[model samples]
Target chain A: MGSAPHAAAPLLEFHDLTVAYGGKPVLWNVDLTIAEPCLFGVIGPNGAGKSSLLKAALGLVPIVAGSVRFLGLPLDQVRGRIGYVPQRETVDWDFPVNVMDVVLMGTYGRLGWFRRPGRQDRDFARECLDRVGLADLAGRQIGRLSGGQQQRVFLARALAQRAEIYLLDEPMAGVDVRSQEQIFRVLAELEAGGSLVVVVHHDLRTAAEWFDRVALVDRRLVAAGPTAAVLTPENLRRTYAGQLDVLDEIGRAVAARGRTP
Target chain B: MTAPWLSAMTAPNTLVAAGGVAAVGFAAGVVGSLALLRKRPLVGDAAAHATLAGVAGGFLATGRRDLPTLLAGAFVAALAALGVLVLIRRFTRTRDDAATGIVIGVSFGLGIALVSGLPRWGLAGSGGLEQFLLGHAAAITGRDAAVLAGVSLAAVLVVAAAVKEITLVAFDAAFAAAGGWPVDWIDALVAALVAAMVVAGLPAVGAVLVTALVVIPPVAARLWTDRVAAMLMLAGLFGLVAAVVGTLVSATRPGLATGPLVVLSAATIFAVSLVVVPRRRQEGS
Candidate 1:
């Protein structure tokens, strides 16, 4: 698959993508193309399928029926090329690990099973941590870091993957203003380096100011385009001001799926 | 190897008790770490109490209290409670809190009934069986405690082998999945570990409240440190302290049920953490 040597390929392509938690679909008809590298935002109200989109796109969540291609191939075909930074609260801060250890996980995908992370892997992790301004704190316990620093550690782990596409789920959620700026700066640098960065965000203010393009989602794709076009009053009202019947239905569907047949 | 001190004042019993209790502490620390880190530290309380019915039933059926055979019954009972919990979550409109409460209240009542009624049924050797409800560790023979110690030790070993994988999965399941770690299996392994510890702890803490060993230590340790490893080690130390102190305390006081005594020791540890430790920063700024 790697031998195709197509550098100009679209980074991500989604066709009629639908994702469900139990049997209830959370994301529907998610047709989009992330061709050129850009700072992208996925915005929606609480319980909207914004987080679902990022997870499904990255193959973290289950897809009901759809096609998601990365660089003209399937997820397994280009696993190493994709990086994911889940929510800041996804990990247990009390885990018996340091920043360096968590960052090393980014290299695990490439190293495969039964292979210990060697010096080269360590060096890449260190460099990634350094880039995220966490080099000095590598040896410190992960739980001790501030929220922003914790988020950066996740980013550093993603960077350690040396991936071409990054899917960050609410990296700025609950973060201080300086951390938000710092996180956005890293993404901007990553975008400038020709990497696709898709972020799931709840804050509309940050979405309006930071993203180059935004997808306004609530159970379905309401609108997706350049930030200015997607975050208009109409779209914002459609996302937050609506009854959220669709999301309620989706949540029920999700709950039903976990039941035994 | 058999402990060789039976000739002394307490014979091999005291050595076995000390060594076995220490192992239990270490195991509790390790097992409790995952539960505590998951932020569901006291989740097993209901299941732990429910195991009493199963323990009594096992003795009634096979007419034996051999540690292994008895534990098999408690394991089944614990799994049954977990299954019931899942059902409540699915079928009833009852929230997780109410469901947990129902299970905790009803199951323990059933267990208490079975324990209290066993002797009236004219069952042989049922007099001492009630101790499991409110433990009497002196009721546990050296062999029984050894078996308990061995099981806890084996569980600690399994946790050690899978340390990296469990830490990765617990800390961030999605990232672990993306990295090709089998997040599901890790979760199963953790459940298995917790269940096994619960079963093993029944002999010392008894089926009525073994979950305390699984929760209290990790919580006490949390107030002392931030890192996962330190928390785990400290939890183990705390559990050991609880187990040893509880056992010794019961040893001193006649008619004090070791189970309640043990849980009280852990409760004391938890109180110390709550009062002496710094308060947590509230979630919303």
Candidate 2:
């Protein structure tokens, strides 16, 4: 199903994708496709396998069934064309590396092994840092940065990858308002530049305002389409009400829909 | 600093011994730092402890205690221990800490039993085998030193070549895997290097505490630098200094073991760094 005959294949596609951990499925039969460039959101409540979807696509997690394709090719064939920003909590920030050292890792995929990043790579990394408003902090240790600054550093690293498809997992979580705005702006720019930016987001209000297309996922994908059509009250109820314990929080997210600016 | 020891340092054998131990220390530090960054510091410890059994097995199999033969056996033993660890993790319900503890206790105990029984069993040429328990650098031959130095140089060169790839996996394995880097192979390379260093360190630091050879310098270096390249260099330097100091100091005293002295010197470096390096950096968490 992922390999179509036409040249104009979808940018990214997850066909009958199922992700499992220890023999138990977390995400089941997710058939989501992004045909063009856009700011796409994977919105879900806590424990809804939102991150799992991205992990499956990146081959970080084992795909129990089905396959994920990027531009009609398997993940390995198109890995160089994709940039990934894992969650901030996924790594130890106290590692003995400065910001510039980390951002240079983005160029590693292209550089291959043994050859060190040279003058050109440094200049490009600095430009990436500049894009994320972190050029001055490039020499500082990653641990010394604020939460928002760290997230921005990660964004700069992803930008340094120079990829056409960017998959960011919870890039805005725990970030200050200014950092979130800057991140969204950079993602919007990527979309405008004919790149696809897929994000795993938790906030409903921002999902409606920021993403051109949003897929509400809860273990299985609930609804997916344009932002206005997919984020209806009925879909939100179905997505959020799966876990009866979080009903109050679900109601709050639903009630705040009108207040979305 | 003593007159007798300073004079002894001029002796060709003493110089060779010190040089070999120095290489082992430097390589251990370089390899150990990568394991430390990977958050598997104790993995080296497990391999270090297992080397004792290998030392015993090597001597028993070859009927000779040459540095290369014994270290070859030790390397095989260390790899076997790591392989067992992987099996446990893959097959059993045991936690990692518990598995590590199991490997250490069982391997170390077997080593002590074997070494102690060698003399009682009347095995020929087993008189000095007990020296391996806590290392005795005074007995190291020039040939042994050359072998140690050779292995150390090789380990260091391997790290120098792959430092970038190793650092990437250490920092963000998921990102590296996503980028199509062979993360498992990199991790395996690190493990194999650690085992080699542990085997090479068996003569100078011994099996009981050789883990310090790999662990202390990297940790101490971490306190002094925020850069990975600088950290690796500092770690190698610290390990070299500690190995040289321990070997030299043990030379001055007849019965003193080299392992404890080496560990103490590394501990001193760690202590000084803890006191001197500022803790003013913000906590990232």
Candidate 3:
């Protein structure tokens, strides 16, 4: 299935995707096609299956049905071309690994079995750390870092993967404003370098300002397109449903930004 | 054949037993560190307790009661117990701790019943099977030591080869899986290595407390360093010292089993590290 008839097939595609946990469906029929390299934001409320969508695409969660394709191929065929940074809270910060060791892990996928990361890989990892402004903290144990530093470290590791398509789950969650700006700067650079950057984000204020395109999701896709077109008041009301406070704030953020939502 | 230098030493049998137990200790520490890092240290305990039944099963099946035959059985039992653990977690609503407890209870009880009943049933060569419960390092022959050392070497080599992958999966399994790394296979490899080390540890540390060999040194080593490679090496060194010291001490004092001595030695190291190291201060920062 490596050969797709259409040369311009979407960079990433979720064909009628569904995800379930313990036999309960959390995400359903998420048919989204990201056709270009852009800063794509998956905006949703709590428990709206935003994380599940990314996890399902990564095959971390059980996909009850449907399929995910990268570059018109199944995951195994194009895995190395895609990089992922899971949620910051998904790992133990106190694990016996320093920042450099964690970043070096990003090279593991390319290194394959039994091959150690060499000097070139180390140099590249250091460069990735530098990109996230964490070059000096490379020797510090991960737990010693603040929450923002930890998030940046995760981002650096993903950057070390050096893939064409980047999927980051809640990269800005619990991060300080400064670190948030640094991460977004790096993501913007990634986009400028002609890479697809899909971020699972929660805050609509930044989602409105940052992402070029956004998908409104609440278990199912409400709408997806250029950020201004997709973050419409009706879509926000539909996706957030009972969460009126969030909708109101988001509406104000959109209007204040003057994005013609 | 034993090493030329080892054979030339006084009391060659004791030296062999010590050497073999040392290797087993080193391997256990290395393997146990991985298990501890994986946050499934108790899984080794479950595999350890399940080994006795395997020993009994081995003897009953082959009736030879040789080290190779019995250890082969113990290895199978350890894997089986681990398999049951995976099955329970996968198919049932039982929590991880409860499932581990169940495996430990059922397997250890079955082992005790089997070993206790063997001699009573008039089975030949079953008289010494109970020694496996608490270990009988004194009974280790040159051949047994060689087999133990061989198994230990293989287990250590596997760890060395996969240390990076193991550390990767342990630290952040979600990232590893998302990057398309075979997290499940790597986890299974670690479980299998733990089982192997647990089975190899049976002759020196015994089924009842062999988990200590695979646990205590790594834990103590953790107190000394925050690096995985350093922790692994220190744990291995600590295990070797404990095993050699315990075996040698037990040799000098008749009627004392080597298993308790080894565990005590390891515990002593752990206790000292606990009190002496500034781990709390570092943790606070």
Q: Provide the overall lDDT of each model, using Cα atoms, as 2-decimal numbers.
A: 0.78, 0.89, 0.90
Cα lDDT tens digits, model 1, A1-261, are 346638776888887788876466778778888888899888887877888887777678888867888888877777788899988776667666788989998887887655668999999899998888878998887767889899999999999889989999889888888888888999999999988999998888778888999888877788888999878888888878764677676667556656746
The candidate with the higher TM-score, 2 or 3, is 2
lDDT by residue for model 2 (A126-174), tens: 9999999999998998988989999999999999999999999999999
**What is model 3's DockQ versus the real complex?**
0.61
- What shift in Å separates residue A245 of candidate 3 from its native position after superposition? 18
> What tens-digit string does per-residue lDDT give for candidate 3 at A1-261?
456437687899999887767645677678999999999999999988999998888889888778998778888887888889998888988888899999999999999988999999999999999999999999998889999999999899999998999999999999999999999999999999999999999999989999999999987788999999998898998898865544455445434535443
DockQ-best of 2 and 3: 3
Compute the DockQ of candidate 1: 0.40
List native contact recovery per candidate, as a fraction of 1: 0.49, 0.94, 0.78
Question: For residues B186-213, could you state the per-residue lDDT of candidate 3 as single tens digits?
Answer: 9999999999999988998899889999
Candidate 3 chain A, run of 10 with poorest lDDT: A252-261
Compare candidates 1 and 2 on lDDT and give the better one: 2
CA shift of B43, model 3, Å: 1.6
Can you tell me which runs of candidate 3 are displaced by over 4 Å? Answer: A1-5, A243-261, B1-10, B280-284
TM-score of chain B only, all predictions? 0.84, 0.95, 0.95
> Residue B89 lDDT in model 2?
89
TM-score of 3: 0.93
Model 1, residue B33: displacement in angstroms? 1.9
